[model samples]
Target: MMKKPGSWRQIVWLLIFTLLWGTTPAVGGLFSSLSTEKERELGEEFFLELNNNYPICTDPFVSSYINRLGHKLEAQLPPHPFKYRFYVLDDPSMNAFAVPGGYVFMNSGFIRLMDKEGELAGVLAHEISHIYARHMARMLDESKPVSIATLVGSLAAVLLGGPAAAALLVGSQAAGQAAMLKYSRDHEQEADDLGFKWLQKAGYDPRDMILAFKKLNKQRWYAGGQPPIYLSTHPHTDTRLVELANRLNMHADVLPKDHDNQEFQYFALKVDSLSGSPYQLLRRMTQAAIHEPNNPAYLYGKALALAKMDHPDEAMGALEQGLKLDPGNYFIRREMAIQYFERNRYQQALSLFQRLAQTQPHDETVLYYLGRIYQEQRQFADALSAMERVQSLNPAFVEVYQNLGTLYGEEGQLGLAHYYLGLHSLTSRALPTALFHFRKALVNLPLNDPHYARVKDQIARLEKMKVKVN
Candidate 1:
């Protein structure tokens, strides 16, 4: 039958999906709404699961660029309860999707396919409109409540390739499946209309929205898996293309001026270079470099690809060349600093990260690196402070937890050390280990301690779960 859940990651997603699906009930009147708070809660949980199970891009420079662009368009809309979030998935499928409560995901493959920032802006705008309209919530409320099981099962089936899901998929009605949940033509039209208007207001050409769909219709570069995931989930692209064309013509008088996006080209190249098979990526970046030997973006791509292939020295040379071309490019500098750290050039790495921290005072990635550098230098206090800041800024950053655990243990802070180890265990899905560490932390932490409550919560959560701890 279907291949049994292909990887541990996929199996974890299946469990998460099933567990989360049970929490939100469709109990109100038909088409009645989910409270903004409930939708936000669900979206947050969903995003966290995606982070744990999927290949999400965590590159600070790229993450910052997408959020800035997504929020720029979001500002044109009237007030809503959402603090909109955008994420880039390290997937090769030419797709993007919006979930409830202002969460939108962009595929790296889709971003790489875009010709310019306008196209990406258009795509983000459309997804934003869908969230603003609460299309998914509405769909949930309108579906036959019983049919929702099929929907969950089908989506979970994508993650769990086991016989149970395979059998479930075989009998599931086409209408009850997740694919059927793709926005209908009317929903697509509404998003298109609102998206284009917002795109124009955001100083991007509305016509690029149409161009985005056209490109999707022609996209063939992907290695031919089941068709692009975008067209499946965001169906009716071919029909929407014609409609978007006429709609653009009708509003030609008020189109916004074409703004040049200096950041997009570099961002796109980074995604392409970082999110591909390393060997093939190196070849593509190298060929591009041959044609435009002085292009820093291409140089950056080559350097990154070379690093991925474990050619550290070659990577360093490419980064040096990139720095000479554009000495002020912070991303290249960031990479060079990372290279230095990996090669144990700790002094050079520390100097570079210190400069980065000054510019990006709250960047967790920069702070994380500083913490690591400090740890290597045996500056325990400094390492703890830097990593503590990172944990405060983004608790989901798994790398910091283990380091914090070690640093705290080294400094003889038994309570905090075990507490952080508990968190690290949680991230790794080691439930019994997490429970063990949390218990140890609680026993050692005094009630007056700042981390006491947090430790209690972690213990309570693990104890509540039906898990066996050896």
Candidate 2:
């Protein structure tokens, strides 16, 4: 059986993970004094901490799909001050949350829970509403001052499901906690109202919001046989459901439009393959493939599960079958290239990636693969070029930083090697280590070097952030 959500082992893991990453001073709550700039900075800091501590799903297909969906919803919203970002957290809990700024995260579990694209849209729309309406800021405005340590401790306790932790944190601030809960309920209602409007405006069915809520409500009943964290925070009630139903009735004339079901199926299967155990996922995909013999997605997912289980030959066979079914499928071709690269078929992998690159010029994953193939082939110049393109396209691609550092070190460019290594460390959220590398790069670099100022600035910024985090 799958491990229950909020299991003790999971809680312990989360507690340890949060502690290791340290804590950021909670920003938007009773701390209404924070300015817009400060809120953005705090959000960035929290993002870094999460990147360091949490298992962020970096699968290229998954990331690209969510971002595309999120941006579509974002386009329908009015202008906002903060730049929005969407991320998938590798957690198997049906939950989603928005930070003080425009940082939104959806758990892989939640993504799997969604039955349709519009259901996913409804979740994103609701979270986006939270950010746009400045709900956190207003909540902070209404509450009394709470220390950062106390707030983090409370959060940790919540994650661990420790009643003692809750009692310890809330005993003195019982009235404040009550008020905050009430305000949070209000925030949920407002988000639902605004989210319904945005989803409809974005050309998605408003009825899907009710679907999403019902799914969560059902999950809450069996979520470790306790209330889910989402319900604890969002608080689903009959009143909320009635409100959603009434809105849908009012907009009953707006007929729901069709979406690309094939694309949705592929994305959903990918999520399932990534989240479930390899053997279980393989069995499920095999059954799916048997039922839908012509569907390439099930074959592709089976191939992925096979690969995860270290059955490369079986994986390749599944991929070949998938390719035969849908020769022009991008995902199948991409998986074939990856499998080829793993088996050291560099030329074949290179040809496939290069072909894909023509259409996806800005895809960092493709560029990274191209760079890796070149590096393995000992084509130093080509490797440098490919990795540089990746850097320019997405600075957050941490693998490129390590590869560049290795490439420069091989060429005996110590300063550039240390510089890129510093960047890799920075992206990995090892601030002190990053600062050390940046300082070393600066020491080796010439005073008149063009890169000198940039290295110095990085070192200074890391130092400041280190102080704040510690």
**Using TM-score as the measure, which candidate wins?**
2
After superposition on all CA atoms, how large is the RMSD of candidate 2? 5.1
- The superposed Cα distance between candidate 1 and the true structure at residue 300, in angstroms, equals 1.2
- Stretches of candidate 1 above 4 Å error? 1-33, 75-77, 144-168, 171-180, 220-227, 247-260, 359-364, 378-381, 384-427, 432-470
CA-lDDT, candidates in order: 0.73, 0.71
lDDT of 2 by residue, 1-470 (tens): 11123444544454343333433422223343546764565556556655655566666556666777777888888888887777777677777877666778888788888878989889999989988888765565455655333333333343323333344334444224334532266788899999998888888888888888888888756856676666766775557999889878888988468555666667777777777788988888888777889988888889888987889899999989998988888878887888899889999999999999897887766877899999998888788888888766544334568889888887777888889998878767666777788888999888898878989977776664453322
* Candidate 1 clashing pairs, residues 3+ apart or interchain: none
The TM-scores of all predictions, comma-separated, are 0.77, 0.80
Candidate 2 deviant stretches above 4 angstroms: 1-32, 144-183, 362-364, 378-420, 438-470
For model 1 the TM-score comes to 0.77
Candidate 2: what lDDT?
A: 0.71
